[model samples]
Target: MSRRLRRLPAIVLPLLLATTLVACGDDDGSDSGSGSTDALHGITITGDVGKEPEVEWDGELKVDKTATEVVTEGDGEKVAEGDQVSAHIWIGNGTTQEKAYSTYDQKQPESVQASNDLSPVFKDAIIDRTIGSRIAVTATAADAFGEAGNAQMGIGNKDTVLLIVDLMDKQVVLDGPEGKEQPAPSWAPGLITEGDKVTGLDFSKAPEPDRKLQSATLIQGEGDVVKKGQTITVNYLGQVYGGKKPFDESYSSAPASFAIGVGQVVSGWDKTLVGAKVGSRMIIALPPAWGYGKDGNPDAGIKGTDTLYFVVDILAAS
Candidate 1:
């Protein structure tokens, strides 16, 4: 049975850029020409880890079932369940031997959790693998997308899919604060205690919106200062001015990771969080102009006129 795709919480992080699967013919299970003993013999890939691979295959490349080969074994930490893994993947069509999607084109690794939501073959091949590993896997239609296949990707019930993945980094999910505790700023609008399980926000008296962004450090960190354009992982809580409760919080969910100053998040976060040291706690108040302007996120119970308030904990940055 095909498993349901679990949607992750809203964050600025980029997961998979493209997942296109298409239907193709079956292979005879015979060697085409290459001397390799693997089921996929005609195909040959040449490239270093972290770079776009050059694929050479002529005739129809097909696999009757799922198979995986470790191109390069890494020396880094082994990946486990619930760990956030960053990888660059190149997917090719088995029928035409043409490239479908590649993260190399974007010049950034897409991060994903090692969960069942991913293809069974893919999750099985990468989990427990060490970082910096290069993996090549072939999956049948049922093992890849599903028996029904995806119409959007032109995938059919019997087609096979090929994937070449470069495992870049892996991070275990953090359960709580990892930095030294500091007192919340007296002038800050919200209060966050180090020992408190839940940090409450008092929006009854809203701070007046200002032309410039207001930011204060609540905890001091010993890590390196964050640089622009680098991806960072964080835990956060957000609320609108004059609201009784927080509209969103990563404290209750997994920490989010995203590149900074890239317009993926609100302008206020892009401006205030950059240059801050990793492991630091910060409070940033965003005016409507910096936040979701005029048409605020109604799903979050934020109005167009509401000012956004945030208490963020910087965890790690790469």
Candidate 2:
């Protein structure tokens, strides 16, 4: 991974949100009805569509079977089985009365799969629901994490995990920059590309090196402008100027996600990426002062005096 970007949690969905959490494999799963049949109806969810909801309840909520409730109906895109949905999830321990996780805190929504692989409690809650919907799920540890339970989260064998999910919109991921090509900057290094893919940065004919940071946009995209403290996704390639090859790139592994303009990434990326729009492709040139500093990323073979350059494709921002 490029040191210019910050690495999100090793697990993007927290507890691998794609894995099965319930053992209900035979049926299509059960969707709880309104009012009495709603297992997680005790908790209150309130908020505008496409945003994280506020959850509240008077007492501990426990359910014998995996219970799901459609907290609110959505008016956005319709989803189907196995399709990926952009959702904000909040997990809490009903037995311990403590909150476990919330996407609001992370400042981004997770891409959850509405497929059979998901737990019965979650799949049943989300299936047939359109974007902008809100679903609440309640299940015991036996039904959620199985018998052993998640020790790190402090959930005992009998504890239950409560989740409130807001299906905001469909996830938008890009394989490359989806923007119009612009004239390359004369001051920056030449971009070597094989078709739509960026291969490396060639600084052979570039201007004399300087310590100050600089940036240039190669492709202009008309998408939402990125802001400070928002989590953004991008495909990037980084190299030490004058080096033969790139030190790291997202083409091989895929797009990476992290908080931007919040010191989570190097200062060069934080200052350059913000105010840019999604789908734009930009290049940045920064000296050691704005890169890894005196302790230039030795693991990537970067030296203290290495002048770093990066080619980035802004994919998504939230």
Q: What is the TM-score of each predicted model, taking all chains together?
A: 0.75, 0.70
Deviation of model 2 at 279, angstroms: 2.8
The residue pairs that clash in candidate 2, if any, are: none
Q: What is the lDDT of residue 35 in candidate 1?
A: 26
Q: lDDT per residue, candidate 2, 55-125, as tens digits?
A: 68648776776777777878887778856566778888887678776777777776555766666767766
Best by TM-score: 1
The global Cα lDDT (0 to 1) of model 2 is 0.74
Candidate 1 lDDT over residue span 1-318, tens digit each: 000011232221253332322223233332221123484545777788889888887567677776677777788989887777888878776766767667676566666667544554566556787898887777665556556653444456666667788899875434444566666554457564456334667744544655356887777776778887767778788877666787787676567676677666777888899999887778888777787778776677777787777888887777
